[model samples]
Target chain A: MQSLIPLMRSISGAVVLVLALSGNSVAEAPLGLGRAVEQTEIDAWDIDVRPDGKGLPAGQGTVAHGEQVYAQYCLSCHGEAGKGGINDQLVGRIPFDAFPFGSDPGKTKTVGNYWPYATTLFDYIRRAMPYSSPGVLSNEEVYSVTAYLLYLNRIVSQDTIIDADTLPTVRMPARDRFVIDDRTRTESFLRQ
Target chain B: MKNSVSRRIVVQRLVGLGGAAAAVPLIGAETKQSSAADHSMPEATARYLGSYPSELGGRSPHVELKRRPLADYASVTPLQDLSGTITPSDLHFERHHARIPDIDDSQHELLIHGMVERPLKFSVADLKRFPSVTRICFIECSGNLFTSATEHTTPQMLCGLTSQSEWTGVPLRTLFTEAGVKPKASWFLAEGGDAALMTRSIPLEKAMDDAFVAYAQNGEPVRPEQGFPCRLLLPGWEGNTNIKWLRRLELSDQPFMTREETSKYTDPLKNGTARQFSVVMDARSVITAPTYPARLERGWHEIQGLAWSGRGRIVRVDVSTNGGRRWHEATLQGPVLPKAHTRFTFPWKWDGRGAELMSRAVDETGYRQPTRKQLIKARGHGSVPYHLNPILAWIVQRDGQVLYRAEQWL
Candidate 1:
């Protein structure tokens, strides 16, 4: 009986360790099926670009070249020079101080008057654009469209060539107008 | 069908749009008149085949999801066509930004990297090997209601953006633990493999709470429109954020502020300030039975509809026959699941008079569904069309006619 005490204690200790770290392991899968994801695999699929320019790929485009690209691929849905069309109006001059939010339902939310980050426009156009074909835009074409739209919105000059470094730093006019959601704070007002 | 066609032929003969001969195919052509007068036996409809070869047959041809006309890829669930809480796997509402990708489940893989100790790649088979959980919940589009719908609108047309189903899958936290997430991670980006490659940033806390990667919805593999192979099911969150065709998850210290979050879903407020990441859906209910297009006669009418909340379970559902003047508690049919659509019933004696009927849902968190005025007051009059869960009313006139009170919001 005395000799079995150590064996019982060892058994209890092993059970405790297994219980503590069961499914969540570093090198092992409890069921053992999948393998490690390499950096190359991640780069192939992780195409999401952030506002801070962290994920913007290496590319360059001029506003002049962008006009040719926009006319050919983007003009029908986005309209002439991005005027109001079947889809959302993309071009509008931003009087940032006089921006309207609620009183006008018809207010055109342009890149200058609405979007907070210049990188967002590039990221969006690169990913989901032309209304039909997505992920077909070349990196240079994406940058060019980003440049052309920025120029149309009067956010940048006509000759501004947008690349990784220049596009991220372009300050959006309505950047200050966006705030972290305060719906929880205002939820009480819902009752009243 | 044959009887209806023959009856329609008799009726059409009086109208003169066409003769009875024109209505021959309207009913079963096989079940034609036996002699001169009529009276033919009902023909055999269809035989049970071994299996549907390619395209599955719609069991009930009447029940159908009404696709938005000439917009994007968007369709609303048939709420009036459905009864009870669980929405059929096929009838689930679809609001895809781009085309639904035809994902090969065997070739599909989810890559979890960025700010994790061990970047793990998981296959569908690997995920199934882990512990699984089943919960009945709803995935609702943030923009559920269109304020300008006409009087002919049915419950499906009104707010059919929401659908409930019993989702079975592995909790995301288990995967997060497997990946060994870093302590500094605050937000995680969920990316899909559709044509648009849709992506949304979710708070890590919310993902760890009850969020799961759902493989099967309502006992079968998740439908193509509702994300196939696997999709992230954030119970009660907006349908856009519950990304379909989920491909990758990247943990980060800050939100990615993607196009969907930045320029689109963000609500424009009264003060010229756009509200970002306004996530959880508030409590709301609609009386579907006595609503628009559904005629009601003066008598004891049992008002029935669905009430749901993203916050938690619905505690009480209050109903009003005479608009906001008088209110009564509705009998919430149990067992009411959390973050799910709960059915409610209220018996009311209609007096054959012009009146307005509305329903108010109060969730477990003491939040009552707001009135139109309250919603407008809270979110300016021209608030962007997202998360608009205002208490709705149906106008009933003395002539036994019902129409949606859609114009009042304007």
Candidate 2:
């Protein structure tokens, strides 16, 4: 933390000062060339959903309603309850005993078996799914599909409703299976 | 001799006609039609003449990537067909989660929103107007080497996911200046405009460091396949985080944990836990030629390959002729730039006996690439299926047939 003290000045002003300190030629900067983005633009594009459901828009969905939405949109590519598709598999997790987390690596990586966060499902589907037409789903449609997929994986019941509140609270079975990267380039992982 | 006589006649006739229109033959003239048989034929004579007028270029007929079977979306670069360090822009390897989309630069906009004093949008033109920077480095997929691939395979098949190019762009910090990033902002989510809407959360410090908003690759506007119009250039990082076809960057205090970073790119350890955000691709090296399909006649031969490290520059690359039994330092080609591919070569004499050929690279950081046994032992037998860079072994038979010493690791 103390090391960053020299870089703590205002971003624009600090850049030149740091350059000058390093003996590089420091030039005064003008305001950037981009235009100020409108709130409407941000609202339209800021669709990423965090694990805590911070980015999920206001909406609710039940597995019952999700079934219809799934059938109408997601059923073809994800195919017959998200199993066996041309693109990727979203259902049918391998048994824990088979791989035991990372004991034996396999080719198959279904959403239920590998994904650590359920909000990731909602976030991905909302932004890019139904392949041919992404980002066209309403908040309701997005919620329904997320619910249907969760129910298909047996993480949620058919009667269970999902919203911003209930969505992030849903713990994924593999949530505890992830670790932070610890590689510093000199680890024995590469020092054979 | 005939062509010279015809050329002299034509030139003399042309010169006689004020060095002009005499060379132009009438459309239906028999003499002009007969000139196709002359060696000095200047007009189209054969069926469908040749490819006309172009400013840029194409590869020699021999250059092509080895496409992954069944997976129509990805292909590996033909490293054996190339010499020196830089990969020709056309032959660069490609791995797309979704097929390449035909993006319209006119309609495209890069929006930097979220925690900021003034959330701003930059057009392709606006980005080009900023203080631009050009750099030569490599962009490599963390998931480059495959375990199942074996000998008789091309270099592209062994490891073709990484490619080096001269990238031109606006410094990401310059853009951050315009937006006035909030002090609390720690991470920024970079999203692509592809069909998958590929996303990853990058640390703000990395953005302020060496990141760029690249718009050109290899002296030309970026290739459509390589995020044309624009892409994020996260120097020395895994290829995934340098999101291609960049469309948005949202700053926040925490990582967005997008699907690519979580379920896809994470590295799972043997302890039932996976490593999240393992974005740094470690040191790796591989021999390009004198391998399978490339038969060798016993004599003087040059042992050569490519070496690179995402951590820094490659300081040493050791060549082993008799497997890992005997090792010698390879001649390091000059301009061993940091985070860029460095070419290494060694002169050798084949004794006409079976031997194993291998190369190990040690980077400036003192990090050495592991052997197959070491790599698997350290990462576990069934480890995460990415960033696998092990010492590759090629068995050279006495009969001069080169074969891959295929061993099970993953």
Highest-DockQ candidate: 2
Give one clash count per candidate, in the order shown: 0, 1
- Candidate 1's C-alpha runs over 4 A off are A1-33, B1-70
Candidate 1, backbone clash total: 0
iRMSD, per candidate, in listed order:
2.5, 2.4
- lDDT, candidate 1, B58-140, per-residue tens: 56465455533324677777776667888877778788898788999999898899989888898999888888899999999
Model 2 chain B weakest 10-residue run by lDDT: B63-72
Kindly list the per-residue Cα lDDT of model 2 for residues A1-192, writing each as its tens digit.
986765675676877777878963643344557888678979888889999889888879988888899889887887888887666888866666233545676556677777889999899988777778877788898898889888988888888889999999988878777767876642555554
Using TM-score as the measure, which candidate wins? 1
TM-score of chain B of 2: 0.85
Candidate 1 scores a C-alpha RMSD against the true structure in Å of 8.1
